[model samples]
Target: MVSNMAGGQPPWHGTEPDAPLGALEVYAEQAHGYLGASGDQLGKLAGLLRPPVLESWLRSLRGRVDPMDALDDRGLRGADLRRYLQAHPIAALMPLIDKLLVEDTAATGLMVVVADQFGRVLSVQGNDERVAAAAEVGLRAGDDLSERRIGTNAIGLVVRTGRAAWIHGPEHFLYRMRQITGAAAPVHDPDGRLVGVLMIAGGVRVARPEILALVKATATAAEMDLLLTAMRPGQRDAARRDAGRPQPAARLGLDVLGLGQPQLSIADRRIPLSQRQAEILLLLAEHPEGLGADHLALLLDDSDLDNGTIRAAMSRLRAVVGPAVFGSRPYRLHVPVATDVEALRAALDSGDVDSALRLHAGPVLPRSTAPGIIDIRDELRVRLRIAVLKSGDPGVLRRWTSGAEGRDDAAAWTAYRATADPETALYAQIEAKIRVLDRRMGADATRMQRFGA
Candidate 1:
């Protein structure tokens, strides 16, 4: 049996004067009763479960997760899984993990499971029999072991809490996982950010307090290996120099153009942004001088919202994009953000019509309904259209007139008519389109006059 050398009292105490095993059994029973009972009964039975475990259980309850639900094994597989492993920062630690845990515990019916920061298991290794047994419950690679999917467990808890966690049989919130026990520790990159989780899991027979320490030590060693690998012979000098100087903040690429959802990319990691956050970021990007909370609220919504609401939203955004990128005082980006809209504007300002046409993906945040976003979108559209119409290049005018944005634009058709060869069929097409637009405008003007009368 593994000794409890970490110096904390065990999670449970038996009511019947029995040994540790019997006490654990009684504790498990009480925990189950507590979970099944109403919120009022939790206070009375709180002592039966560890503080961390109780907190996890409460979160699970809030999420409306069922304790008896089967584990969800949904994630990248085959070529996608291989590609993910190759690009993941934790890939370098796989050899060390295999050496320390997989090889050592293979014959002992123990499995070493490694998961990304999101609690998606990337790899699982051990003895054939044990590995197969673990797979029966969906503990293999490409499975989501997050608390939201599988209820409270060591892997999910470590990812959520960013600390070492231990969960033995009966302590697990899931009835199906009651026969298993596990210890998990968060793996960190050289900069001390959580990169993944390293866990050693097995049947209850092999469960021991010492497993937590083992997993912690292994994770630390793997991190050291990764740090050294990053500072190889050629990069040692540069890495040392970089370490001495303050590192530059990472850049965020915001793509708000077109009808598709806006995407935010930082360090090659791309994530989709909600329309509200996209609008806020776009406005902030436009006004580098920054805007106060009241102005931001006015731009974001017509309804009245206090500064606190905006502050809370900014806080949540900072958590995702990092504080270095999203700044507070007046509300502006601290780090440089490159947006497609800005790129197109720059190309146009430089009088590079060809480059500007190439850069313009579509209207900026076309589907956005925010008042500020609408204003900026219209301004950009008008500026680009005017710039293209003023350019005398037949090729540039032809490209613009053919696209959806310029198809019905009267100015674009007029520019095409002035630039295209009179003998060409393309010139006839442009003339026909101009006549159609003229008729549409005349009908609209007549309807407006009738309405006024």
Candidate 2:
């Protein structure tokens, strides 16, 4: 999309992954530098970021968010969210949202998220798995995507400038959130009052120049729907109506295994979580039956912690996670919590070792020492090792043996040897490593026997 070029704040357009549309490489590189730059260096390279993104970046910087801070972005939820939704004009537009954006895009694998003028997400509707993926990254209903909260996102940009906009991957302010790309448009009520922002989040497939147009079109449709729905009989005027829309909301991913750093991805942001938080969350996820506060406390720690302490901890966690996720009768998850662990388990159970290997990023929460976490960790590790050994595929075995967890695994190395032709150098190397391990094991056994004496 060419620069329309008019006012100080120009009417914005869309984004493409690469040129003949725009200089994505140049802008992305400059964004990286701009985000890293110190005070004076920041102004020096101002022109490169494209005025819209730079302005939003400035607003984001002025706001509470730090580009480098771990994103803990949240929106509204529970009773408070229900009240807000009921009162907001966007509430009437949900049917249109469900029909035009959510249902139409279901098979296309895109996601639709609606946010108020403040950029706090109102509703997220789409394919079930896609919605779950979005939730993992803090992009669910009641989560804020405002420039002040998450920084330089498509939704927040539209709110900042009151125009249609698209933000590409690296254009995002938060560092870890650079994996996402999205396009958004502002929805105006029939009276032209700013209703909210509609965003479509997805992968690079959404980076095409037409994405903003699609967003704009859907946003316009939402606006028109508000108009028609608001009109009583034959009311025909711009003043009679009310609305908001998205990026694909589609490509959501939760990574608990990558480098053992657990993060949630929705749209273009990856909200980071603490290890303890991740442990409690994943444990809750494991037990669909829901653990009681006492049992939950025991699972979280070996010590006999009181329910009050657990409740306090749960309260703090609930603030970060929002209220709709957990139920009180028994501490249970109200939604499907997908993780690399579950994905890997599914893959392994289906006898798909290749998929399991791809999903296994070392052991789950490698540093976690909680008994429940340790239990899951050990169980998953053993299961993965068994699957890897059973595969007999040299490439799969090589991948397993290459990891730190499996580097000294004698069985895996032996399996690799069995799969390889004896003449191959790889086979010889496996043999050599196994011999070293055997010698080490024998020496350790001898030392143990002497100690027993």
lDDT of 2 by residue, 33-97 (tens): 66666688677445556567777887777653567765353334575566455546677678877
Cα error, residue 145 of model 1, in Å, equals 1.2
Model 2 Cα RMSD, Å? 17.7
Model 1: per-residue lDDT, tens digit, 1-453?
322334334545421112376556566566687777786777644655667777888888866667777655345566545545554667767888888888888888788899987676888888888777787776777666778657788898988888888777777778778877788999987778899999888876545667777898999898888688656674556435543211234456789988789988754357788887888888897777898999998988888779989988887776566555656678876765667776566445434566578877788888877788888888887778777877766777888988889876676677778977899998898888877877988756534422432
Local distance difference test, each candidate: 0.73, 0.70
lDDT of 2 at 435: 80
lDDT of 1: 0.73
